[model samples]
Target: MRLTVIGCAGSFPGPDSPASCYLLEADHEGRTWRILLDLGNGALGTLQRFIDPLGVDAVLLSHLHPDHCMDLCGFYVMRSYHPNGAAPPIPVWGPAGTAEQLAAAYGLEDMPGMRATFDFRRYPDAPAGQIGPFSFTATEVVHPVPAYALRVSVGEKVLTFSGDSGPCPALVEAARDADLFLAEASFREVDDNPPDLHLTGRQAGETATAAGARHLVLTHIPAWFDVDTAEDEARAAYDGPLDRARSGAVFDL
Candidate 1:
């Protein structure tokens, strides 16, 4: 599987990167299967630089925050109004009421809203879905609104994404023994951070340490925070292969 970092900015769009969007691609049959982790602010424009929007096989949203799923509106337009023709509806897995929220955001009627462009499906708590060669597992994480920490596995290789979360057991459980853990280190360790919200750089590293993740990629740091600070804090807690996620960064496994 190939992991491409489309955006890594936290909470909102940054000057250099978009919000929180990731692209995962793997080979299935004779073609490549693609799935997007999130479609955050300013991701649509940047996404086309990597792959054609029509080639997206599925989109898995971590939550309903504008910074996490807002760009779906722009994606809906491209898929619904392509010059060649309307693109086929692709699966969109998200939190409960995801369909309603997207519909309201795009100002669409209740019936067939963005559903015409996207086949929106709510993530099931017990049995997660499998798409092509990937198996997805979503664990509820501590956040203001409904959100999840996602673990995607292809055979033995695994990639875990800690979608905006504070210190929690579920987050650790979701990332257990992951090959690559993409953690959000939005808040710094020195700040007076809140609970059940976001992770500090040290906290992100601690989670990676506890989960026994092989490689840790610190991401989702807002422009206000320095990546060096996050790396310094994370390095203190974890002693593994670590890298700061940046736009256009690619990881192959």
Candidate 2:
């Protein structure tokens, strides 16, 4: 399995980072399976830079926030107008209101060419099921909107993605024993203004330690925060391999 960080910015996009998006690819035999964790703002273009836009087989949304799901419109356009127009609809998986949210985002209950463009599937808070080579479980998180952190297992390797959330036990349990934990360290400890929605670097590290994750990759950090200092704070709490995520960073698992 290969994990690619297409974007890793917080709240809004930064000059250097786009937003929140991760691509996971698994190759078995001669077949390839592609999955996207979140398609945040401007991630469609960023995705084109790494892999073919049509190559994506499935999209899983973490939440309805613009920074997490706004790029589906761009993806719709690509699936509708690209030279390879006959491509099959990609399966979109997400939390309960996913279908409605996509309809509202595009301003159409049944938009033109939408049925032909996407095979939409709404997943509940429980273990939904499998998609190709991966199986996953979703747990609700504490966020303004309905959000879920996913635990994905491909073969024997497991990876957890904390979309965006405050420090919560659901996240810790969902990521337990994960080979790689991609968590959000969206704010510095001192900058805890809207304190209940995002996690600080220290909080993220503690979560990683408690989950027993082999490696922790801190993401969703604002551009203004000192990256080195945030990493140091996490290191103080987590003794495992800890690192700050950068745009375009790729991990092979």
Q: How badly does each model clash, as a count of residue pairs?
A: 0, 0
TM-score of each: 0.98, 0.94
Candidate 2 deviant stretches above 4 angstroms: 110-113
TM-score of 1: 0.98
Query: Which residue pairs in model 2 clash with each other?
Result: none
lDDT of each: 0.93, 0.85
Off by over 4 Å in 1: 125-127
CA lDDT of 192 in candidate 2? Answer: 36
**For candidate 1, which ten residues in a row score worst on lDDT?**
120-129
lDDT of 2 by residue, 1-253 (tens): 8999999998778888888999999986678888999999978888889999788888888888989988998888788887855678888877777767777888877444366788776667444668789888778898888788988888999999999998989999988999999999887877635855988889899999999999999999877877776788799899998877888999988
Deviation (Å) of 146 in candidate 1: 0.5
TM-score of model 2 (CA atoms)? 0.94
Model 1's lDDT to the true fold? 0.93
Residue 60 shift from truth in candidate 2, angstroms: 0.8
Query: Which lDDT value does model 2 have at 62?
Result: 87
Task: Tell me, by TM-score, which candidate is best.
Answer: 1
